[model samples]
Target: MSDGRLPTRRRTVGWIVAVIVMLLLFAIGWVMVRGFGALSELQNVRHSVAQLHKAIDERAVDRADRIAPRIAQHTELAGDLTSDPIWRGFEFVPWLGQNFTAIREIAAIAGDAVDDAVTPIVALAADVDLTTLGLSGSRIDLVPLPKLADPLSGAASALAAADARARLIDLDGTLSLIADAVGETRSMIEDAASTVGALHGAATLLPGMLGSSEPRTYVIAVQNNAELRSHGGAAAAFIQVSAAGGTISVVRAASGLDVPALTEPLELDDAVLVLYGDGPWRIPRDMTSVPDFAAAGSLIAQRWQSQFGTAVDGVIAVDIDTMRHVLTATDAVQFDAFTATSDSITTVLTNDMPQAIPDPAAQDIAFSRAAQAVLGAALSSEEPSSLLAALSDAARDDRIRIWSAHEEEQDLLAASSLGGALPHDDDHDVHVGVLLNDRTGAPLDAYAAATITTAFGVCDGTPATQIRVTWTSAVPEEVAASAVAPEGGAPGDLRTLIAIYGPQGASARGGLTTTLDRRPVVQQDITIAPGESGTATATFTGAGSSDPLTRLHHTPMLEDPEILRADIDCG
Candidate 1:
């Protein structure tokens, strides 16, 4: 009777074990199905959002309007899948627990971004007549644009929150591939947030800057980067432009050389005196030497006033490449020796025109004529949106910069990258600056290229950092000699004062030309004949950081802007 009872207990235990196994299998199957469904929905959300962005970029209002609702729907679906009951059942499951948590986090991030930025953006899009805005002339109506400020501001706030949330996410360990995808989604959200922030700022500021109140006067200094300098390049030419009642007019135009010398002694900074000497101030002829645009613009305004007896409200500086970008809106203009089209204007102005007339005095004539022709064609352009787009593109590339004496106007420009001021940032973990002041008188920088690298670490309980700056000229030895001189100076010899602004509180130690006001300067002399690369390195003790972000604020040189970012781990 006892043996029979034991067999009965064993049979009962077997039935219980089989039931538990069956339930586990069912739960696993449900998790897998739910996870895959969430993933699919997330992918759909991504696709829909991408399509919406494309529609907005292409100004396809109807398509964007249609896609916006779909984006919201897909995002909501993704959120539902991530927060499904299956995830709750799998919360205690090994490996899948982390994945489920990450998925939910990603879904929430996406949904929040869509709600914060996309919702307001779509609503704003619906309210505005994009096609009409695009087709309008150079002048934009500021009255209706101010109404967009609230929505844009809301979108900006949402994006800021998204970016902050993204930084807090730990998308690693089990199911890291999915985690990586989630990380990418966070990056996209950050980018969208930045766009919305910019739109918000523009909405809030554009009305006043575009002459909603009174007329504004600006001096446009056209920099020829062939003779690259700190701020941009030598102001090769300048145009006085005015905006009144939302209309822009070219008041006057002349070569930089045409602006007469300043008689009075101009106050100068130590950096300007050390790098440029008394040339820019005494003569007001060379605007390139001073890296500070505010200072340079002040001097330029003085000269402008001296010449024209009219005060300028601000100064806008742009290089030759930016001019070519502006020309994209217009048809080609026939110059003396060649046609000035958007594609050819840079070459014609920098190479062909320079080479055609070697006389320094005669160069301005060509530049003035080319400038006038390009400006006329650009202003007369029927595609005002295209012109603005081209200008915006150039501005993003750092080819265009603006400095305003008016505090109110400058407040707006200061918030933008176009504000050509050396950043006084202390909150950043690391600040690295590579400022090049061309020693070569010619447009040799057009052929010169640079590479910058920084290594950081902690040693003996103190931070240590090292910066390496390498410069090379691609100009052939034979042609380099001829290309060396610009205006009137040494030929083939590329002499540059490379100022390396190291991390804050870090002293530069090594072979340095001179240390002026904490900035270590390295003088590089590269002749066209050698084709050899010049290298400069400086080690700074006590500059290491726990946070390994390396921020580079450099004078825009001839390099892909993306390639200049050097972010590496700190030891």
Candidate 2:
């Protein structure tokens, strides 16, 4: 019995040892399963990363290739605008306008391409699928194992990692290319936009020059002792136009006609007439020197007033170079031909017509010989009118020639036509005054007003400030007699006064007693430093005028010109 019991006990012990071994084996198997599962999941994550990298690289390369051509085109377009001769010629004509559409289109395309390339990548990143790759949860489920583990899993993971790194490198390179391309495209667009903007600004003035119903006339009145060619003395030409009647005339003032004394009123039928001449005639460069130009212009204006009983509204002067460039650029004549013809015409006009070009023979001879020959080859047609027409046509194109002389005329024309007029008074009278002063009350200089207009409104009456005064003429028929000042001295003495007059006797006044546009004048005090300037404004309403000139006449009067002195010391 004892022996049997001992054998049984040993068997029991062996069974216990077998159970312990089985438990150890099971633990090892479980550990292996979990380790493999985690590894597989990491491999899957890496695979997704590799795929994403590849997509990013491919898209970047595609985008760069797509935008490269457009970038090149935009660069070329920008270059052409600055360098192309045809474009330069086109600038002379205002109507051709600017070519901004092409630039805008290219910008739009580049913007769109960037959007398209980035959108898909962003979407793919946001909506990546992990469930299909058996990565639904954070922990791996060991119960759902495939019959055979993917033998290529490790190899695939290694390949994926390598591919991903390569793709990232490629992506980096492609992005750099894209950045360069975009930069080039943007630079080109900006250049084109700026050029187009300038062109547009210049072209905006054409309509005013061409579309005015009034006769656009210019009077070339010589103010100097320059020689004339027609009769061998001083020469001048009065270019006149009647838009309503479709009549144009060029009159030659008789030699020895006192240019300053010829301030006679001449009838211009609803026309914009500018009196100008060839001379170093003084013109005010700015408010500081306006008086000099204004005084000189005033003399000319007085001549018109003496002759026609009304002052001229506008005045301009041109040099010999100006005339040459205008004619040359418009006709597209070669430089040599333009120089010759211009010289000849200048000689004839300066030596002969010491007064004006009133003779038909002179006009015919001048136009037929030198002028026609210079213009003939330039125009498609041989008619003198055609040459003028060609010039007009060229002015409408967007081609700006860089000739300094022509640029001056263009600036002058733009100013005269578009810039508002200076202040004036009824009876076609205008007073333009400018004062320059140091920080103290001492006056340094004074200038004639080059521009005066009611458009500037009122004076704020701030000390040391420069003020502009304008007046409009009054027409007796337009306003009631009661509104008139009774032709005597003003009714009241006021610190500030403004009077407006218009065609047909329309008039209004403003001060402490009179109101502006029915609104009482508000006076405010402002302090100015010794070297600083300030302005005071007073406005008057309820005045009527037939034209801008007439309205200026009815505006107001500046009582103390010294009060509006400019601060010169501030500079």
Candidate 2 stretches with Cα past 4 Å from truth are 1-212, 220-238, 242-258, 262-302, 308-316, 326-571
lDDT of each: 0.69, 0.29
TM-score of each: 0.79, 0.24
How many pairs of residues in model 2 come into backbone collision? 102
After the best TM-score superposition of candidate 1, give how far the Cα of residue 111 lies from its true spot, in angstroms.
Answer: 4.1
Cα RMSD of predicted structure 1: 5.5
lDDT tens digits by residue: candidate 2, 67-153: 444433432343333333333433344432222222222333333332332233233323332111111211122222221123222
Q: Kindly report which residue pairs in candidate 1 clash with one another.
A: 226-443, 439-495, 441-486, 442-485, 442-486
Model 1: lowest-lDDT 10 consecutive positions: 561-570
For lDDT, the strongest prediction is 1
For model 2, give the 10-residue run with minimal summed lDDT: 440-449
Predicted candidate 1 versus true structure: per-residue lDDT over 439-493, tens digit per residue: 6666657767778777666545556566667777666565555654633334565
Q: Which candidate number maximizes TM-score?
A: 1
